[model samples]
Target chain A: MGGTAEAAGGAGAPARRRQARGQKRIEEILRAAAEVFGEQGYDATTTNAIAARAGISPGSLYQFFANKDDVARALAERYAARLATLRAELDTVARDGRDLDELVAAVLDPLVAFNLAHPGFKALFARTDMPAGLREAVAPVHAAIHGRVAELVGQLLPGRPADEVARVATVSIQLVRGMIPLITGAAGEREREVMTGELHVVVVSYLRRQTAGAGEPGRA
Target chain B: MGGTAEAAGGAGAPARRRQARGQKRIEEILRAAAEVFGEQGYDATTTNAIAARAGISPGSLYQFFANKDDVARALAERYAARLATLRAELDTVARDGRDLDELVAAVLDPLVAFNLAHPGFKALFARTDMPAGLREAVAPVHAAIHGRVAELVGQLLPGRPADEVARVATVSIQLVRGMIPLITGAAGEREREVMTGELHVVVVSYLRRQTAGAGEPGRA
Candidate 1:
């Protein structure tokens, strides 16, 4: 029995190595796709361009993605997963009794970092013509973010109607979404930081107005 | 010469009437297209659907428009002309010495009214997939609006750097653009008004903070 197990492990080693290589190749393709899509936008990007960017043959690209849309959908799923993780982290911050400015920073910093890290995420998800399947893949995550924002709003404005809380949350989300392109498109890190500060000011000012005299006694 | 002119006019009456009828038909088609586009969105809509919505035949629709993109371009042109007029009016309001809230209202109310009147305008222009020609048709007006806002921001923050003024202006426009969908999509006139009010608050608060010490001493 021990001899048979050893033989099986030896046989699986090459297969495991192949599987790891396949995973690495997929990540490389997606990284290349993100760069291309960010530069050329969704409509202008092509699988051939992505393959070239990936340093792979078009045939190799086809092994993983049927088309640019498939690449975009995969990217959307990746963004959604990352956003979900960020949301959980935000959930912790929201309940940590931080003041409005701290809370706003906690939320915006990671998001801006994520957008800066993945330059293609906004270009892919921001399009109104995003493929329906891709939108579906991202929609749940977006809804969750909205829900989480609303929950935070409710906490800050303790007695506000749910509808009002939701409305403020929706506007807040849109406000951040609207500013993201500006932040991400800033020419350099310094400019991006400035834009991010502006966003923080805009959001904090608005939330301060909305949550005034409503939350805990000492919360800003 | 007077008698000859009168005779020409008499003969040209039928031709003039035919031109007028054609103009009216074009207007009807555009109006229907706007409604249909607003209802069904840009991608889902077809020339055939526009024709049906206009109570005209497909052939008749094509007589005026080469395709749905042409119809959207025409609509974009129409919207541009209207926005140009609105911008001129806003120029008057911006210099009228209104307080921050009043100025915010002046800018937002008319723009909101224009959006409400033309439900299809946002639907058409908000799309990232908007046809290139259609975007070209509307691009000038959008730039003009941005410039106008920047000019206003410069006035409010007298000594701010040009870049800062432009940045504020860009963010302000995006802030309003972000809220328009919420305002337009509100369930009723009352709800829409509430959303509009909320938007006004957000913009005014942000501007108040930005222009805190740089503007005229007596200004808000």
Candidate 2:
């Protein structure tokens, strides 16, 4: 057994190097796919385009993904994971006892950054014609975000019913979701900044009205 | 010339009748297309299904539209015209001396009814993958609504700059647009009503904040 283990380790070292290379290629392909999808949208994009952008042969691209839908599904999974991380960070922020304005900024600023960094995420997620597998991959992340927002909402409006809290949270999330396209599609950086500020005002204002007189005395 | 006119009238009679029948068939096909598009979304819907739903043969359906895109474009034109009419009505409502609550209700209620009556409108309008021609057809109505809303914002905030008013109006319109799916996709009619009311609260709250100290002396 000792002799067999020693022999296997020599092969395992090269195998591990190959695995690392494969993983790096996969990441490169995904990053390239994201950019192409973000620029052209889902339907207009093709695997060839992604391969070209990634500087890989079509055969190499095919080795990693079956088709464009497969690539989109992988991208959706990537976005879901990133969103989960963001939500976890937001959970931490929510527990920090920030005021409502602080909370709004904490939540939205990271979200805007995430959206900017991952422009393809919205391109895929926002598609009405998205394949069911891709939608399934994205849906839970959305629900998790909604759940987290509802928890925060419940905290803010302590005496409110669960349903009302959930409703408000849903509306709040939708409001942010709706503004994303506008913010991302802004004509210039100045326009984007102004729209972002407007979003903060819209969200913070609605939340204040909803949570008015409901916050802890000191918090209010 | 007299004999030519009489001869033309005789041939034109059946041509006119055929034209009327063609128009009626087109409307039925459009009505059916709208329902199918709403139920199954654009990608899943096929011309055969639309023809079947409209109680026409595929051959008959082809007489009016070239393909699904053509059908969708026609439907878009129809929606654009209806939305224009709705906008004119909204313009009348804006001119009336209604308070903000009444104004919001006036705007949203009819819009909700329009969405309900034509579920396919939101289906097509909300799609990120919508075809360019269809999008162009819908874009003007959206812009007109935005323009009208911006005008109202300008009135409410009399001294505010055009850009700020435009931004507020864009956000306000987006807030309402964001809620349409939630309101329409609610689990039940009761939930729908609750979501609709919540939407009203959200829009009203945000607008009130934007317009709070800006309304005219008597208006405030």
Candidate 3:
């Protein structure tokens, strides 16, 4: 599907140049939109401010998006696509037969990489007012990654139910998400490494028990 | 510090009346501020809007707060105080004799209850721009609760390190905080029960792990 767009662009030089320019303009608009939304929030952010930041006119913005909401949806879609690529890349990095520590590291490293690479975009993606479709689209990818982590937990602790495994997986992911902004800021390098190491030990010890047959009783 | 304020107010009837009125006005301002801040956000929400919401002139708003930042700080302080009270209540209700599930419920239930009772306050509390002092005040209370939960986890799983247990406790608390807003409407009853029940299950299961041997290998 992406290949078709590239192929069509290659067929006509002038058309391709115009298309490339439009794409660049859209990217610029999205970048400006993310900053505005992050700083001022979704409802208060205006198309005019976004246009001013992008060094474009409102009419140019309208040519690409219907309005602010449309721009938000588009931005969210782009972010979700980026996250999907990261998820796939992380999956491709084989976890089989690795220690649980390494498997957990594999699951978390790509996410940290994404956060470091796109801190502003990460903040925007975490915003509450994100479009419903974007939330729906990202939910399954989250669930799939969580499922894989749960399977790893299951292997480490074969006595636990699949549900319990998944619950721990979800908690681990939520913690990392909470820590992203904190880790990125003035906590210092040593602080982040310590927090990460602490989190690792937490997961390992929690899992070791169910495999040992002394697991706490789970809620029905 | 609190005793000093109480002593000052206790010295005379006029002082007591003035203090009561001042506290009432502050509450009104906070209520108005929450609505404005939630609707318009921190950067865009105006002191005038907050004053108007409270049926007062902009000058009257300045009597209590120096500016919008002061107003935000006051709101955050009130919220942190409320959260502290809620944590205290949870600690009072929780008994060590209770099983892990009950213990978890006792720890989380009061927080959910407070949010259910004050939905607007919950929304305001969730806002990222909460004042630094308020955040700092909440941290020790959070740490206290986290430490208590960590001790419980250690009891349930005898061999886990205190540091590791504390990390899981922190993770669980963070999860509950993030999940509450997603699953509950600003103040709706139906969503409240659903969110609480969902949280109950997650906490119960996450604590009950599969691999429990001392210094067990990290491999799944």
Error of 3 at B220 (Å): 8.7
Chain A TM-score values for every predicted structure, listed in order = 0.77, 0.78, 0.65
The digit string of per-residue lDDT tens for model 3 on B1-220 reads 1111222235562433347776777778888887776565454567898899998888877766655655655565566676666655555555446666677777677767766555555444454323343355345445555676665556666666766666556656655665566454535665456446656665564564412343532233
TM-score of each: 0.74, 0.81, 0.61
In model 2, which runs have C-alpha deviations exceeding 4 angstroms? A1-18, A57-59, A66-70, A87-89, A127-129, A213-220, B1-18, B57-59, B66-69, B87-89, B213-220
True lDDT of residue B42, candidate 1: 71
Better of 1 and 3 by lDDT: 1
Better of 1 and 3 by DockQ: 1
lDDT of 2 at B53: 96
**C-alpha positional error of residue A188 in candidate 2 after TM-score superposition, expressed in Å:** 0.5
Residue A156 of model 2 has an lDDT of 76
Q: Write the per-residue lDDT of candidate 2 for residues A104-176, one digit (tens) a residue.
A: 8888888888888888877776553455656665675567667878987887778887977887797888788
Q: Every model's Cα RMSD, please? A: 9.4, 8.5, 8.0
Each model's DockQ?
0.27, 0.30, 0.14
Candidate topping TM-score:
2
